[model samples]
Target: MDKEDLKKLVQKIISNHQIGVLSSVENSKPHVRYMTFFMKDFILYTPTKKNTEKIEEIKNNPHVAALLGYVEKGSNDEYVEVTGICSISEDKDLKEEFWNDSFHNWFNGADDPNYVLMEIKPEAARILNSEHMKTMEITL
Candidate 1:
């Protein structure tokens, strides 16, 4: 798909689902954590505490998976699964742009020492709608 298609699909999926289940590896075991994420500049951002297990797991294994979609009891809806490599970024501008009140609860205020941002640069994303699926391959 072209960049516009991908961008539109991303916005659609993100808008439909505000919660994401982020999977990471820790102690050679897989761990999944549900988090509220906001995106900026096409980069997925998740604010976490400096000492959280998720942060350490990402440190040990950068590969991660994010599931962003939901289904009601009887409704059929497609979901996006994005698997990518993640990095802890300290970009001042990005931190400011994605900042919000929820973060304040975790950070105890802006610029809290425990605040850390995880940047997921997707390597490959597959949109699954039952038997129909499309994959968007990425570079870097």
Candidate 2:
């Protein structure tokens, strides 16, 4: 697919999915967590806690993997795996844009000092469907 087609596919997959499993390396071991993701252009964003080991893991190793899909019995299987480099941003404007009360459940309420935001810029992505699958190298 061309760039425009690829972008459309990626955006469709992201919009159709809500949660993604984020994998990071922590002390040479793999750690995985569920995240609610938001996207802008081609960048992926998620929130986490500063106290969480995952935050430190990302700092130590920027490499990450993410999976987004719909899982239900007898449903057509569709999913995407995203490989990327990520960074932590403390930009006040971005923080405000992503803020939501629903995040309180994960951070034990909104005022939690440890709350942090992670921005993932994907370098590659693969989309898998029941009929076909394709992998594309991306420059984020």
Across residues 10-114, which tens digit of lDDT does each residue of candidate 2 receive? 778787886889999988888998998877778888888787777778879999988887576625567777889989876667777878988877775444566
lDDT of each: 0.74, 0.77
Alpha-carbon runs more than 4 Å astray in model 1: 1-3, 130-140
Instruction: Name the weakest run of 10 consecutive residues (lDDT summed) in model 2.
Output: 130-139
Model 1 clash pairs are: none
Candidate 2: lDDT over CA atoms? 0.77
Q: In angstroms, give how far residue 116 of model 2 lies from its true place.
A: 1.6
Query: lDDT tens digits, residues 2-103, model 1?
Result: 766766677578667868899999888879989877666566778788788887788889999888876664145667777888888777777777778877
For candidate 1, the per-residue lDDT at 61 reads 93
The TM-score measured for candidate 1 stands at 0.83
Q: Report model 2's TM-score to 2 decimal places.
A: 0.83
lDDT of 2 at 119: 90
